[model samples]
Target: MSNFARVRPIGRRRDGRPIYPIKGGSPTLTEQRDEVMRLLQDENYDGDVAELLQRAERIAGEIELAQQREARLRHLRGLTPPGDPDPNPGQRQQPGNQPDNGIPDPVSAAEAFVRSEALRAFRERGLRGESGAVEFRAAPAGTVTTTTQPQQNTRVPGIIPQNPDFPLLVASLLDRQTSDGTTLEYMRDTSGPQSTWNKAAVVAEGADKPKSGPFTFDLISTSLKTVAHWVPITRQAADDNGQLMGYINGRLTYGLEYKMDREILTGNGTTEMQGILTTPGIGTYQPGSGSTDPKLITVRKAKTQGELALYPPTAVVMNPMDWQDIELDEDANGQFRVIANVTDPGAPTRLWGLVVVTTVAMTAGTALLGGFRTGATLWERQGITILMTDSHADYFTANTLVVLAERRANVAVHTPAAFVKITFAALP
Candidate 1:
């Protein structure tokens, strides 16, 4: 064969179709064997051989990982329904883990229902486990020991024990009186040394004698004192049992009024009067835009054509020696006015102006009319302004108010002398 033909073919045939060599290289069996032996023997031929081995290992690792993921997916698909027992006893399961069975355990289901129902009852009536069934019983003549045991499940619907609404009711009652001043006074009575119903037990009829439980509502009156202003009650009375007996009902009122005094002077006249009216309880003037910083000075005197005039002389000293004195008087329209001088000169002289008077009146009495009016007016101006600077301000009212109320029935009976105790069976 020629040299070209002597070279080995670079492809192989499998049942007639040709399969090309990977790198266009073809070697005889003897040559391939010699090349493999040379690679094993040559220490200098180690350039990319380690890298190729590492790449092969990486591919093997990927294949193993893929196989593991496939195995996990198959295992997951084989899982049964919850509540179903595991097929293999040796296999461990997580807590709360149950078989895939559709049916839940009877015991667990019953317990869940009971718990859910109990919670529902507690929320519906605003009850707490510690509430309800205040106890009262005459002490036994002899030694009487009592024992308690956890009640077994009775599987009765709507029979689970719940917190009575009494506590919530009491809270609501106290909230209703939060704004009443008399409520605070009553609260103080409950807290004072002479309190009649402090730390007394309440007992309900048809119940076992309960273990001694201290009273809760006695000291609660103190909390009501904080918001007493809003409650605004005139009179309040409570019985020895810590119950509200009666109260005076009325609305609070407040307002502000103003009066102005003025006087007029003729050619030669003088007038004298008291200054502007002021707020009744206003101890000090608040210097601000809306407040009376520059108090209105009263028109003490108004004089005309005189060396010492009541007011500063406005004339430049040129006249025929005529004068009138101005005076403050009530006009026919009932409005205060500057009256003309009683005596007038033959010829009309230059009219002299007298001092002007302004007044602010704020009266807070039993009616609260002044304060309420002021509050309303200020509220209409957006909010009550206690004080304000060029760019800063302060207010008394807040953004919102929330009110809640409730009625409590058959509360515990308490007096200065003794207390009562009662108990009842726990709900299932």
Candidate 2:
């Protein structure tokens, strides 16, 4: 047979390297060994042909090991392989043939073969719904009892696939709580958003002139919101698929987390939770008239706003693109403005005494500065959860499983004035 006869090309890489999909169930050791020998006999083979022979040898070795394991398993389970006849067919075992141990011989070889065949059918067609029927014939009386061992469970290498890089979220940097209560309630002073200090004048003994009124308070509330997404996968894919599950679940979790982060920064309070940017009466800042670098001005204004509200801003969140612009900004002399020197150690994540969080969630031309722990709270009803079920419509009949990943949380900014939103021109 031609060397490439059994191999079917699946696709090619960008560089045109041919890719082949592995086909067929596990082969017998003798078949694998013979294939390897045939490849070895090709003396005129070059580098690629030699590589093929090497792969065949490796496969042969694996098959031999598998056969040994199969034999051991068969011995333990009292199953018989084809061509191996049990001395007793359908008759009850004689005491002489029976072991002293009370346990009777496992299932007869025929029963084992039937089970094996059924399992093979399940693996091949049950997942695809090609055939759901299984049939078996009774072994004739006095027929030899054969033993067949089940297949060993061999784990595939590289079970964990490489994951795509996901944007790190700043949501965790803020104050978080596992809320037992569904809604967040806090008291807000209505008399004024901020507290004022009054200086007492040195006057007469019984000065009853100045009258101070009690501060008015209003209760503020925000409800917890649920964020979720679902992926529908064939039940076969969920079970038989190895590395693929890792990739799918990881990507799904990352996607959900990134969305939550963005919502905390910009979610509108209609059906979704209200975010810091949408929080009523939050602070705002604008860049100075002539300054090319807005980092300094941004931090100053935001910090000043929070300080004015009696809450000092502790973190700055901006888009990666904007941070890049700031980091690469040059002065008249061609020297970097943000980095002190060329050898500046790590990625500059700190600026103007505030922890800088660079994420794509923030708009390209906008930034948010806030005293996260003091101004707002993240109440998590449920963390990221993953589950698989066929309950989705028609999925049970269709052999499909729904992989759901979801989170329930809400962002409540009790002191909106303690946060600041800075909008600037989009960098070129």
Candidate 3:
């Protein structure tokens, strides 16, 4: 008999691996085993470790069963060799075929043959999908294995997850509130006197009470703007739970936050929120001409300006470059200027008793010190929403899907005088 029963292949895998009869699965055991090993060696593999260990154990068990099955098939084939014919219709063993030992029962001798046939039949049922069976040894190497082209991404080892380092954000310092309408309207006490108290003095001897000019206010109205983006993915990718979640948590969600942060600080305000730097009436401080002040002193002077405006700054926002300069600054003694523990990673970033928020959103040469809790309010007409649809463009016909992320909000610098914009550029 031939070493292997030659039968047509069932089908080919996406990876160009051939699927054979006994194996009964597109990816044979070796393909799956390679995936687990590849993931273990991968530096970026984020899959659960325990699951892989369990899968390897199952694969080992299946391989042992395959070897046992091969032994049984060989024994069955040898019972009736090819080209041998049983000529008699009711063939019974003659005296020549009888056992050499005296008087062995015919029934006892037939028992061994019956048991072997039962095992072979049972194993055949498993190959036909009648029972739980995995792929087995069917390759030319005598060990089960599958091959794939290097260029085929459809049949990848495993879904590789993403981990991104989003920049330090400053939006958390600003007060947040939700709104129901598109337009956000509020009245600001724009022209408050330096001496708000004792505006109206008490009159003596029934004299007419002094009339303080009516408090001045300016109407401020801002329209909510949309921050939105979408990505196109294959329908198959969208259905993959790991791939979909990684896109949202790593890329799409990060995009929304990054755009919103830039808008809150430097948006043009015509098509976007009226960012703190663009809002009118806020104080501005720069190093005076001929003054060789460092970025650290400039930020401190800006904080004083906010205090002078009667709204002491609660937080300071600067470019990461500027913050790094400040953190690295040293006095003539060569000791660090800032007295805090420099090596403590968990320490909160603070400057002049105010919360320090460093972000690239703020220009490299500028900083903002403000009473963020009271100076500006972030109005959310709609919170961030994520939607998946196959109806976008030609995605439906092309078997593609769209993942969209959107949010609507406007920035209103209510007490404009409370914020101080600091220019760190050297003044001539």
Candidate 4:
């Protein structure tokens, strides 16, 4: 085999000199480095054939490296724009100028990025005819590049201010208020003690001036009540965000109105508004069987109560959970028994010819079905009103504002017998 085809030795000797190949074997480029080092240190060594050969190899290696550097310089020159000064004047250009395979240098890339970002900002701001400036900040070593500053130190997305409409659940179910806002007095006529006296039948046309009958009359009266709530917020919040104050006021009003609705439905009269649920003479139905069909009991008890009172039931109020059970009840064939389909935008609100009002205020397992409007009246002394002020103690000095929502209203059950409470046994 030819010497050029032989495999060369690798690595250095124990004496710190590299292991060179045997005669006729070609010296590897790797050995050129050691040969160059030897040439630098060995002053007394004469130029023998072997030494000359080693020197020649070292020189040839140097020439090859110079050629490669020239080629790289030529490539860089091609990339550099005309008339641009060198970034490192009077110093050797670092290999960082052109990383692996001619990729852009870090410093140049950063400058270009800054320019592009500045130009973009200028254009977005529409600052025509104005020059833009970019500031450079040295990042800590090993910091990952990011398009934006870290959220912890930068302006992150702020809490999306929430505005929810939790309007009164039961108020909407009540008949609309129509009272002229006049007086708190409500009057109803009642049968007197002798109002039920019956007349004796007279002989054909012979009436002895029907025995004088007694006439009597009675009256019923109810007064109005009120409800209110308030919220305090910074003036800056109210002023900076146009909707902030309005949202607070509206939410407070809904909260107050909702409480009023509950009070009107179930309040005890002692220190609270009188509601129909506690009114005297109101009917009550107990299913007593947890397994009893919800739909059957609801309609049957409501109709019976209405019949007894000589008035038909018009509405039913139940907890949303209880209503869900009634609405989702299935038959043996898997068909919806209480509600076949509900096209309403929200939860189901009607069932079996009665307006079904599902509210969180009503207790689960209990429902009220009655002629709500026909048997009762919602009297109003003053409608809902929203007011803002800095008049509260320390509010004006603290840059704070007070927002109030209030209403004056009362409920009167003219015919308590027209309403009925239907209670279901607890679920298993």
Q: Estimate each model's TM-score.
A: 0.11, 0.53, 0.56, 0.51
Clashes in each model (backbone N, CA, C under 3 Å)? Answer: 49, 8, 0, 0
**Could you tell which candidate, 1 or 4, scores higher by TM-score?**
4
Tens digit of lDDT per residue, candidate 3, span 1-428? 88997875433444546556556546677776666566567665555678767877887888789889988775554454334455231222222222211111232222222223432453455346453211111111111112422121122231121111333455666666666668877776565423442257767997888766566678987799988897887756654433554565455666777788889998878888778888877778988777888888888888877776668788888888888888888888998887766585545667788878777888888888888766877777654555555555676678676767677788877777778889886533
Candidate 4 regions exceeding 4 Å error are 1-169, 172-183, 187-222, 240-245, 288-291, 340-348
Model 2 weakest 10-residue run by lDDT: 95-104
lDDT of 1 by residue, 301-372 (tens): 112112121112221111111111113334568654544444742212222331111111211110000111
How far does residue 356 in candidate 2 sit from its true spot (Å)? 1.5
Model 4 superposed RMSD (Cα): 34.3
- Looking at model 2, residue 197 earns an lDDT score of 26
Q: Pick the candidate with the highest TM-score.
A: 3
Candidate 4 lDDT at 15 equals 59
Q: Put the candidates in lDDT order, highest first.
A: 3, 2, 4, 1
Best by lDDT: 3
lDDT of 2 by residue, 53-167 (tens): 6777687678878889988865645533445445333322222222111112244322232234543564466557563433332222221112322222232331122111333
Question: What ordering of candidates by TM-score runs from best to worst?
Answer: 3, 2, 4, 1
